[model samples]
Target: MDFLNYTEGVFATNTSGNDSLETTKLPTSKVLLTVTLSIVAILTTFFNCLVITAIAVTRKLHHPANYLICSLAVTDLLVAVLVMPFSIMYIQMETWIMGKVVCTIWLSVDITCCTCSILHLAAIAIDRYRAITDAVEYSRKRTGARAGAMVAVVWLLSILVSLPPLLWRHFSEEGDLEDQCIIIHHHLAFTLYSTFGAFYIPLLLILILYYKIYKAAQTLYMRREASRASRHSCMTNGSMIPSSFTAGDGDIDGGPRSPDPISPPEKSFSEPSTEEPPREKVRASVKAFKRKTRRPESRSESRRSQLYQGPRISGSRERKAASTLGLIIGAFVICWLPFFVKEVIVNTCGSCSTSVEMADFLTWLGYLNSLINPLIYTIFNEDFKKAFQRLVRCSNYL
Candidate 1:
C-alpha cells in the first residue's frame, strides 16, 4: 500500500507521504488562462461599477424599476469583487489556495452573489409583467419601499440556499477539502434542495412571467394593428365620398336625379310663364343647393381618427418597454440556462461528471449574464444612456 495510487485517471496520490492529491493541469499555458480571467474580472467589475454609478448619480433613474436594477448591479459587483478573483486563481492553479475559513467565505459569497443575481432577474421579470399587464395598478403598487422589500427577500433566499453546505460541513476532515472549495454532493437531498431553490424554481418563475408578458405584448400589438386598420378603412370610406360630387340638373337636397322631359307640356296645364329666370337668381339657387347638400364627412372622420392619439402614444411606449424587457429576459435565459441545466444534470446523476474546463466554461457563461445585463437593461435604456452621458460629461443638473 506504499505505492502511488491514482483515482479518476486524473488525480494521483502517494500512500507513503502526507495525504495529498495531484490534479491534472490544463494543457494550455497558465499565463493565457490567467490573462483571460483577469480581463473578464476587470470587465465585470468595471462595467458593473459603471452601472451602479450611473444609476446612483442619475436622478431620473430613481424609480422602483431602476431601484431593482441597481440592486442587480450590486449583486454583480459583489460577484466580480468577491468571487471572480479567487475563482481565476482556482481555475489556473487547479487547486484552492485559500485556507478553510477563506474557502468557506469564498464559496458562500460565490453562491450567494450568483443566486441573488438570478433572483433579481426573476424579480425584474415579474416587475415587467405587472408593469405591462396591469399598468395602473402596478404603477400604484411599484414603490421604492416595495422594491426594497423585494431586494431583501432576494438576498434572504440566496443566503438560505447558500448556507446549507457551510452548516452541514460534510467533509470528514477539513484538511482533505482544504484544496478544493466545492459543494459536497454526498448530502444528496440538501444538494437537490439547494439546486432547485437556487436555480430551477427561479427559472420556472422567470419563464412563466416572461411568457405572460410576451402574450400581453402581443395582444397590445395586435390591438394597435387592428386600430390602425380601422382608421385606414375610415379614411378610405370618408375619402371615397368626394366633396366635389355634383348632381345632374335636379334638386340638390336629395341625391342625383333625372333631367326634365324634353316633350312639351299639355296645353290644358295652363300657359307656362314666358319670361326666363334671371341669371343672378339661378346662381343664387345653385349656391343655396350646394350649401344644403355639402356634408362635413371628412371633418368628422378626421376627428374620429384623432381620438386614437392618446392610446397610440401610450401603446408605443408600452411596446418599447416590452421589447426592452424581452431582450433582458432573453439574455438572462441564454446566459444562465446552460449552466443551471449542467448543474442539475451533474448533481442529479451520481455517475455523471464534467471536466474542469467544461465546468469553468459553463460557470463563466453564467457570469457573463452579469455583463450582458447592464448593457441590455441600462445602457440600452434611453434615460440611462442620457444620464450616463451627462455623468461622463460632468454636466450640471437641470
Candidate 2:
C-alpha cells in the first residue's frame, strides 16, 4: 500500500527528497497561498474582534446565547491571530523552521482553539434548545454562575485535550535529513483523542439537542394556535348572547305598553326594569380596560418567550445560521479527516511515504475552519451584522 512505501522511505532515506515524491519550487503558488491566507487571517481576526467588542458593549447582547457567541468569537480570534499566521509562515517556508518549542506551542494552540470552538458551538445549540423548549425553566437556571461554570468547563476540557499531543510529541533532525515532528509511540492515542474529543462526541451532542429543540418549538406553536381558536369562539358567543337578550327585552316591554292603554297597576309594576344602559356601559368600560391591558401583556409575553425560548422565527434567518455552522463543522471534518486517515494508514501498513505537502495543506485547511466561523456568524446573524455595521459607522463618523 501507499502507507508501506512511505514509511519505508522515511525510515530508510536520509535525503530531503524521497523516491515517491515530486518536489516543486513554484514561487507563484507559494505567493498566492501566502497572500490568500494572510488576507483571510486579517479579516477573520478583525471580524471576531468586532464580535467580542459589540457583545461586551451592548447590554442588550449580554445574554446566555450571546455569551456563548462571545466565547466562539474569542476562540476564532485566537485561531486567526495565533494559529493561522504560523500556518501561513509554515506553508511559505515549506518546512518546519521553528524549533521543537514553537512546534509544541503551535500544536497546543491549534488543538485547544479548535476544540474550544467546537465546544462553544455545542453549548450555544444547547442554550438555544433550552430557551425554546423550557424557556421559563431555562431562564431561572441560566444564571451568571451557571454560565461561568460552563465556560470554565469548556476551556478546561480544551486544555486537557490539547496537552496530550504536546506531552508525547517531539521533533529532531535525524542525521543530515530534514527535521520532522512526530508523535512518539502514540499514533492510536492521538487518533482517538482527536476523533472522540473533538469531532464525533460534539457532533452527536449537537444533533440530539437540536432535534429536541425542533420538536419543542412545534409543540409550542400548536398550543398557541389552539388557544387563539378557543379565544375567538368565546368572544363570538359572548357578543351574540348579550345582543339577543337585550333585543328580546325591548320587544316585550314595547308590545305591552302600546297595546294596553289602560293597563292594570300590577301589570305595569311587573314590567322588567330598564337599567341595561348603565350595565352595558360598565361592561364596555371593562372590555376597553382589558383590551388596553392585554396589549402590554402580549408584548411582555412575546419578549419573555424570545428571551427564554430561543429565536421567534425559524425562517431563513435561522436556517441560514444553522447552515453556516453546519458548513464550518462539515468542512472541519472533511479537512481534518485526511490527516487522521493518512496517519492511520501509515501506522498500520507502513507502505507509502507520508506526503508532507498534502498533510501540510490539509492541516492549514483545517485551521482555516476557525477563520471561517466568525465570518459565517456575522453573515447569518442579523444582530451581529447590525452591531458590526453600527460599529463601523460610528468609527467612520468619529
Candidate 3:
C-alpha cells in the first residue's frame, strides 16, 4: 500500500510539472502569428526580387514607365530586405534583439522606402496625365535631362521626409522589456507627421491627379469622336452629286454647251464616268485622302522612331506601368489606413485600451502590403507578366 501511494504521488507530480512547462511556453496564438508573418516576409522578398530581375533583364521594357516600375521594385526590395527580416526576427522572438543602431537603420529604411514608393506612384500618375493629355507637347518637351531632374527631385523629397523621424529621436529609446526598440510615440508629432506627410497629402495629390486625368481623357475622347464625325460628314457631302453631272458636261445653270463632239480623252477621263460613277468618285476621293494622310503619319512615325532610338526610357509603356503603380499605391493605402486610424484613435482617445497583440497584428498586416505589389503588377501588367514567364522559362532551361 505504501509503495502504491508513493508511485501515484510521483505520477501526479510529473504530470503537474509537464502542464506547467506547457503553459510557460509561448502562447500558441503568438507562435501562429510568428509563423504567418515569417511566411509573408519570405514571399514578399521572393516576389520583389523577381520583379527587379525581370525588369533589369528584359530589353523591350526599357521605357520611362518601366523606370518607375523599376523604382517601385527597388523600394519594395529594400522593404523586404531591410524591414521584413527584422520584423520577422522581432515577431518570432516576441522581442527586438537588435541594438539601437540597427533599429535606427531599420526605421530609416522603412520610412525612406515607403515614402519613395508613394512619391514614385504620384510621379507615375503625373507622367501618365501628361502623356495622355499633352501627348504631342510632352513628347516634344520631355527630355532626358528633364526626366532625370524629376527623379532626383522625388528622391530628394523622400529623403527629406524620412530624415525628420531619424533626426528627432523617435526611435532611440530602448524597450521596457528585454527585446525591442520601441518607438516613442509623441501623439501630436505622430499625428502631424503621419497624417500630413504620409497619408493625407499623398492621398489628396493622387486623387486630384487621377481626377484631372479622367476629365482630360474624357474631353480628348469627345473631341476625337467629334472630329471623326465631322470628317465623315465632309466626305459624304463632298461625294454627293447628281449622277448625270460631269465635270465637262457644262450643266451649270446658263452655262454654254461644249463646242466639239471630239472630246479629248484626257478631259473625258477626268470627268466622272456615268457607269459606276459614285464608286469611282469614292475611290478617287479615298486615294487623294490617303495621300494627304500619309504625310502626317510619316512625320509622326519618324518622330516616334527618333524618340525610341535613344536610351530606352520605358515611358512608352506608360499606361500599363501607371496602372500597376496605382494598384501598388492603392494597396498600400488600404492596408495601412486601418493601422494609422487605430494609431490616431489610441493617441486621441485616452480611454481606449490598446493591446500589444492588436498592434503587432496590424503591423504585420501592413507588412503584407510589401508582398502584394509585385504580384499585383505581374498579374495585371502584360509586359511584366510576359517578362516573368520568360524569366521562369529561362530559369527552367538553365
Candidate 4:
C-alpha cells in the first residue's frame, strides 16, 4: 500500500507540472510564427506607406496612370494596418480575440480591401490597354479625374461584393460560432458568388485585356525593329560600295592614295568594247556605283528622321506595360488561387472536411499578395525607384 501511494503521488506531481508548463510556455513554432507575421506586417506597412509618400512628394510620379498605383498602395496599406495584425493575433490565440462586432468589421474590411486591390489591377490593365491600343485618343482621356473615378468605382464594387455576407453572417450566441471568425464556407452559393466576383471575373478580364495588349505591343515592336534593320542594311551596302570603289581605284592607279576626277584609273579587266579603254570603263563603273549608292540616301534620311522622332516615348511605356503586366498577373494568380480553390472545393463538396490550420494558412497566403504588391510596383517602376530614393533622403514625415 505504501509503495502504491508513493507511485500515485509521483505520477500526479509529474502530470500537474507538465500541465502548468504547457499552459505557460509557447512552442518554438508559435514564437517563429509570431515573429514572422510581425515582420511581414511591418514591412508591408512600411513599403506601402513609402509608395504613398513617394507619389505625394515626387513631381515625376504625378501622372494619371500612376494614380491607380497609389490607390493600390492605399488598399494594401489598409490591409496591413487593419487586417493582418488582427489575423496574427487570432491565429496565435487559436480563436477570435475581439467580440462579434469587431470580428464583423475586420472581416468586412479584409474582403473589401483585398477585392479592391484585385479590382485595381484590372483597372490598371484596362488603362494600359487603352493607352497601347489607342495611344492618341486615350492620352487625351487618361486624366487625373478619370483615374480617380475608376478608383472610386473599384472601392464601390468591392464594398458591394462584401456586403452580402453581412446580411447572413451573424455569430451565434453559443456553440462553435462564438469563438471563431471565418468566412461563410458552408454556403456554396455565396462562396462561389464572392470568390468569382472578387477574383475570377477580374482575372478573366485581365487575361483578355493583356492578350490584346501583348499583340498590339508585339506589332509595334516588330515594326520598329524592321525599320532599324532596313536602315542598317542600306547603310552597310552604301559603305561597302564606297570601299570597293576605293580598292578598285588603288589597284588601277599603281597604288595611288586618292582618286582624281580628271584622270581615269587603269584596270586589268576590259569591257570588250573597242571604243573604250580599261581606265575609262573603270571610271564609268565608279560613277554608276556612286549614283546607285547615293540614290537611297534621301529615302533613308526620311526614314531615319521618323525613327528618331516617332514612337520613342511610347516604346518605353509599352515595354513597361508588357513587363509589369506579366509579373502582376503571375503574382496575383499564384498568391490567391489556392485559397479560393480550396474554398470552392470544400464548399461545393459537402463531404469534404476543412482544417482550421489549412484555412488559416491559405487565408494568410492570400494576404501575402498585399505585401507583394508594393514590391512589384517599386521594383519594376523606374519612376518609383527615383522617387523612393528622393523620399528616403528627405524623409521628415517618416
User: Best lDDT goes to which candidate?
Assistant: 4
Candidates 2 and 3 compared by lDDT, better number: 2
Q: Kindly list the per-residue Cα lDDT of model 4 for residues 1-398, writing each as its tens digit.
A: 00000111101112334645754675777789889988989999999999988888778788988899899999999999998888788767765557878877887887788889888989988888887776655667889999999999999999898777655555423214566565443665777778798889999998999889787766665554444445445554564221212221221002323312222333424334678888898887787667666755665675467556546755775777678778888898998888777766766776765555566667778888889998886787778887787777885542
What is candidate 4's TM-score against the reference?
0.72
lDDT of 1: 0.67
Each candidate's TM vs. the true structure? 0.71, 0.67, 0.65, 0.72
- Residues 23-133, candidate 2: write the lDDT tens digits: 345667768878988998888888788889988876667776677778889988988888888777765655557776776676677778878887886787777766665
Which of the two, 1 or 4, has more TM-score?
4
Q: Which segments of candidate 4 are over 4 A away from where they belong?
A: 1-26, 171-176, 232-323, 395-398
| Cα lDDT tens digits for candidate 3, 302-333 | 44454344223333334544475567567867
Error of 4 at 2 (Å): 58
For each candidate, what is the lDDT?
0.67, 0.60, 0.59, 0.70
- Looking at model 3, the pairs that clash are 62-314, 63-313, 63-314, 63-315, 64-313, 64-314, 64-315, 65-314, 65-315, 96-179
Ranking by TM-score: 4, 1, 2, 3
Instruction: Report the error of model 4 at residue 356, Å.
Output: 1.8
Question: What shift in Å separates residue 237 of candidate 1 from its native position after superposition?
Answer: 6.4
Poorest 10 consecutive residues of model 3 by lDDT? 1-10
Clashes of each: 0, 14, 10, 0
TM-score for candidate 1, residues paired by index: 0.71
Top candidate when judged by TM-score against the true structure? 4
What lDDT, from 0 to 1, does candidate 4 have? 0.70
